[model samples]
Target: MTVKKGLKDAYSLKTPMDSVNLYRAWASTYDNDFAIKNDYRSPSEVVKYYSKYSKKTDTPILDVGAGTGLIGECLREQNSRKIDAIDISSEMLNLAKSKQVYSKFIEADLTKKLNIASSQYGAVLSSGTFTHGHVGPEVFDELVRILKPGGLFIVTIHTGVFHNQGFKQKLSQLGKCISPPVFHKVNAYGSKIDKKHGNDKVIITVFRKKMS
Candidate 1:
């Protein structure tokens, strides 16, 4: 496989297999080659809103699209609860496993019904998943389905996708099931060598499942 590792390759993904293959090869160097090199700040940004809005409870947390455990590492620092990870790439999950941040690492596609039970998580957090050529708002129903009543659902959606994609419409469709979403603009990367992507930004969407 021709392993072309760059933001363009990630942004150009058209299918789940594309993600699987790309990350499978890129997993080993993902942190350094892409994340650190670009001064990726999405994970920390997700954690910031999570810390501000979510209660530190024993109820398990699920990190969706948890590539390389970046979010998991941050969450581990804040809470020592049972945090589980779900991602499509086993290679990425393997790297995440080494961090020892997640109690469970699940390899599954978010485009399908996850093996997880409904209302099983107190909070579901994700970063860098809802972007161009990646999973879209289509998975929102399933993500929300896994959250316990009153549980928090926090994720970072690339600003462009949030507007251009169906995220706004999907959130409205889920309005009955969840509270009004709170969106926060966040820098997707800090000081970076990648000038083209240095200005990338995201909207950290935070909302809670309704307690009926």
Candidate 2:
């Protein structure tokens, strides 16, 4: 799928391939155009919150949908633990590699082939992924599968009326099955800038995998 040349390419997700292509095309200016405007504080805030409950261990962190290495860079600054970032777009991963924030970068599709093993990561962090509207239950299941017992999964979601019903219920069910993971509402006032794209309310949800 080739990326469209304008703003429509940025907000619309016609297919999973389109999302990958769009990010690949937008990688050069992704931070300048979107990251700063929408989620400037997301990476830092995620690091801060995760640090409060857990210490940085030698175990690696898996950053899903890790575009441009923003989250990996934030994690690196917090401590020197290994960080592996994965994205579907080689262009995006290339941009992320240029930042020199992650220890490893892999190109893979979360919904199709994760390529990461179960109980391998100490934490799994993602930002700006769920909000993109492409992720579904399959991605969620893969995320849960990759986490070690007691590992952390942090993510942000575009809030809407739909969050109160269908999506919320699915997440609740996921939490129950995935080592009893618990969701915490993260306030957006400190981490995100209010923007008018859609009527979606963005919220961060942190889940802790239960210890085996």
Candidate 3:
């Protein structure tokens, strides 16, 4: 994949919010420039892996930071289930909505309190939230609260130097308050061409909420 020098430069920035804004600005060209590259297989693989354990029930799925609904579309392809996509960027959600891949799209920051109600989702899946540091540990509680008992939370994180052990520990602490959620590493892949910095080792993690 040919990496644009401008995107490479942007990836080297010190803050995660810089990357988020950069993505927000490039949301229009995101699919052509980044998402479709690498055979569009990275995010597709994430959804495919998680779908295996998802219950056959027609439960609602929430895709956090659901940029352009790539993962959501993949999930829909795997199973005829309803998906709600949420992202902070309207531009991104606009592209996602145009595809008609999600049943609902909400513009909201996952790091803040999500407006979603407790026990609303049977499963929550996120493909690109943690890697860019757009979300921190505090958001896990909201994710847990939004999921029904025995629900699943699937997320992806960068595995190399950028991985936040401190934030993971904080999430672990918060897990103690919820029904014991178990975290398991699912798969690893490369980031977008713009995110070539830090060696960009993408690791997907799955957390399943225990039934009461």
Q: What is the TM-score of each candidate against the true structure?
A: 0.96, 0.81, 0.80
Tens-digit lDDT string for candidate 3 (100-137): 86899888877678788888888888775665335555
- Which pairs in model 2 have colliding backbones? 159-201
> How many pairs of residues in model 1 come into backbone collision?
0
Name the top lDDT candidate. Answer: 1
Q: List the residue pairs that clash in candidate 3.
A: none
For candidate 2, report its TM-score: 0.81
Writing each residue's lDDT as its tens digit, candidate 2 over 1-212 gives 63434334544675679878777678887777666655566566667766765655526788788888888778777777788888888998998898887889888877785777788888888766775445654577778778887787777665642264355766777766554444555543334444444334455666766675
lDDT of 1: 0.90
Clashing pairs in 1: none
Q: Which residue ranges in model 3 land beyond 4 Å of their true spot?
A: 1-20, 161-165, 177-199
Worst 10 residues of 3 by lDDT: 2-11
RMSD of each: 1.5, 3.7, 4.0
What is the C-alpha lDDT profile of model 1 across 1-212, one tens digit per residue?
A: 64659788899999999999999888999998888887889999888888888786526889999999999888778777788999999999999999988899999999999898899999998999999999999999998888999999999999878978989999999999999999999889888656787788999999999987
CA lDDT, every model vs. true structure: 0.90, 0.69, 0.67
The worst-scoring run of ten residues by lDDT in candidate 1 lies at 50-59
Angstrom error of the Cα, residue 31, model 2: value is 1.7
